[model samples]
Target: MAALEPERAKLDTTIPNESRIADYFLGGKDNFAADRAAAEHALTIAPELPALSREGRRFLRRAVRFLAGEAGIRQFVDIGCGLPTQGNVHEIAHSVAPDARVVYVDHDPMTVVHGQALLQDNERTVVIEADARDPAALLTHPGLTSVIDLDRPVAILLFAVLHCVPDDDLATHIVTHLRKAIAPGSYLALSHPVSDLCPEKTAKLAAVYQAQGTITGGRRGNLRTKAEVERFFDGLDLVEPGVVYTPLWRPGEETPHRPDATWVVGGVGRKPRRPREHPALT
Candidate 1:
């Protein structure tokens, strides 16, 4: 394990972090009072928050399994990896390919600590403390580079985290940088909250998150539309059934799409083997 920087080791229990609050929503006890308070408040707005969390996690597991089992992607760079939970990216990927490598990135100190503990014995996994806003910093981090091979196909997992990024241009830039760093045939699996599912409820919930000082609230941290979310996959080949609700994205069981249950939208896309040529080209 790499040595933790003093700055990254500090844990502030006063302010509620989105990752801890999310853990609270998922029924995890590794959270502070601030986290639970914020989660409770958010729940008042969107009553289905807990369900959304569970479904999002399930979507992550299924997506990772698909990437590893079917896509044959053995390396994963899971950005904004929330509190260490069961069946994480590495756990799912390694289950299919023991040699699979994963680098978990998050700005939360608790997340890093918990993730490090959970992945202690797993030599193929490494947890790095870094802000998701800076893809270059994460991509070039010593811990990540040690395990993840940029030259090979890597699955960039951006599950339920992009909303934390407030700036649209910055968010797009980060994705672009990461996509550019990876080789052809790499994959990107992402899930994000959408306001369109339950506009009223989501709007109210955004207020709760804002009051708690969570990253996304107000104009900065609200949910995005389906078309806006699709922009993240620019220049990539979306997998079949692209950009749909979590439950409907290649569901494991015979579950029908619930257009109303719109907390999250998720999909997988593959980087093409060759760059698209301009129409004016020969």
Candidate 2:
């Protein structure tokens, strides 16, 4: 709670927040006026923008189900987890394994507040208010320590958050650091908004977000290409059908196929267990 105080102090209604805007698009009531205005502006440019959000949430849920049921991952660190809504990470994970532990990380004060409130009664989950770029801080947070085991296989969920990280180098560094820091069997799941799908629409929507001062720290949205999105999985072994469009990645019967204009890509990868070196000949 003390650690989140700094993030709480940074909360302001004037600056629209990416998480809140996402919540708005997801049809959650956790967003404020600024976030609604930004989402409304984005809809004017792309009326199907809300579909993108829903698709992203579906990806997250499916990924969790796969990890918990198939991969046997009981611990999850959901970075940049936006406002908690129905079918949250914990709920999806625990649905498969009741003992699942989830640590949610986000820098938005309202997100932290809402997350804490929503998870207060859940003993196996916690919300840590911190920047996603600082994986060290997030991993070392007291809340995470209380809920997760760093040495055990865990799933790091970065759903719909990578585009908020503007700096390519910084984003790569963050993923690289987490890859090495967590256990060898750990997994990374990510979804990013790609600009190549509809360049003009992407630019227009980005401009609207920027003009609203959508406080994703300093970046607006940095959409990427499919190839560019693959870079985040450099050191990890991608799962089957790797790095495909969000709806196309292991689509379930209920997953709806979207047009190229949706532009979001997602994937899940595992950090391979490094081979041990043999002793020198005596």
Candidate 3:
């Protein structure tokens, strides 16, 4: 708790924090009055906000399982990881592979504090306070590299986070920068709310969220079109059924109804391995 004083000092309970609002949407009690009010206001615009939140979590679970189970990846770096909730990255990854190592990064001070407290006893996971827009700093942070090796094949999760980067150029830079750092065969999994599903409705919803502000300084929410979201995976090999609606990504069975309500597209892409060098003939 001594570490919480500084983190708490940096917080403003009056302005709704994006992570806390997300927690409220997921039926968590860690939010303040401002967070609740903002979430309620957003619900008036899009009544399906809560459901979309749940669907997002489902996509995250499925994606994590695929990475730690099928892809055989043991290292994970989950950036912009919001408040801890059920089926967290480490919990899901550890279920498949007990040896899996995970590092959760978030810019929110409270989120980092809470995550640190919750994960204190868990040796396999650690949380650090870092901005997603600055990929270099967060990627190279001693706290992050300590848990997961950047040189190895690591799975980077960006679930419901990038839209916070209002600047398209910065978003592109963040993803491309990260892609360059990871070794060949590393994976990137992301889910983003898209404007392609219902442009007018999403636009209004975006307006509502903008009014309340976000964690990424003064920049408002930027809901990208499905095509724009897919561009984040450039230079990587997309897994099967690339960048589809959240529930449709790999639902297997028990598919959720009206997946379009989620208004989000998700996909997993792997960095292709380098071709072996040719031997010099004698």
Candidate 4:
């Protein structure tokens, strides 16, 4: 694989980025004290955040395995892919399908740089510095174009990233555009932070992220109701046991049950060969 070098010198270590902070929560050594402090503050507001992160990660692994092994998905476009952690999308996907191709997209310089470094020897993977809000940019990137065949079935991974998108319409637009770009049989695996699970505590953490100059901006984290999340997949065919808590989304092993308000919701939907046209699309 050719090296896709990023301008790493431009990385700003002063500010706490979502990717690095997430790395902190995952118990990785790539984060700084500032990131750790912000993560700790976030925990103060929502004590189960670390656990939520773990569950979310687990959900991602399970989803990717299903997509590659069971769903016969060979291509993956992971948007808002944070810093490379254990059981990353590419690793899990390739484990089942050795030929599976993955394109990771994120605007964070650190994530792009580190991901590129980690994926250097993997010709089947590519990392592009692109924001999830701009699906066009991501779709048109050389790296994405090189790895993902848009006209074929692909799994679009939006795991734990929609919270960064505050504009409801833009969030919808991003998914709509990407869905249009892919052929039928494509899949969308999404996991988002939900305030309904722990409204007060989640809101408090949202405030901390806002104060930390993080991209989340205290913008309510777009913590949607379960029905609203279902709205995002209006035209797609939802998989079995649809739109449940992250741990409950096809939990392979028996997971310890938490309170009803667990702060995260996840689901996978398949783009039918003939999906109903939505009024919103017109």
What is the TM-score of candidate 3?
Answer: 0.91
RMSD of 4: 4.6
Better of 2 and 4 by lDDT: 2
Per-residue alpha-carbon lDDT of candidate 4 for residues 1-282, written as tens digits (9 for 90 to 100): 112223422467776778888888888889877788888887776777777788888889889999998899999999889999988998899889999999998888888999999999999999988866667877998888888888899999999887766556777788788777778899999998876765666666666776676653125543666677777776778897788877788877757346275668889989888756854323
lDDT of 1: 0.80
The lowest-lDDT stretch of 10 consecutive residues in candidate 3 is 1-10
Task: List the candidate 2 regions with Cα displacement exceeding 4 Å.
Answer: 1-9, 215-222, 275-282
Model 4's lDDT to the true fold?
Answer: 0.79
Please report the TM-score between candidate 4 and the true structure.
0.91
Query: Model 3: residues >4 Å from true position, as ranges?
Result: 1-9, 215-222, 275-282
Model 4, poorest ten-residue lDDT window? Answer: 1-10
lDDT of 1 by residue, 9-96 (tens): 2577877888898888887889998888788877777788788888888889889989999999999999989998777788788889
Q: How much is the lDDT of residue 126 in candidate 3?
A: 94
User: Please, what is the whole-model Cα lDDT of each candidate in the order they appear?
Assistant: 0.80, 0.81, 0.83, 0.79
Clashes of each: 2, 0, 0, 1
Candidate 2 at residue 222, lDDT?
42
Total colliding residue pairs, candidate 3: 0
Instruction: Report the poorest 10 consecutive residues by lDDT, candidate 2.
Output: 273-282
> Estimated TM-score per prediction?
0.91, 0.91, 0.91, 0.91
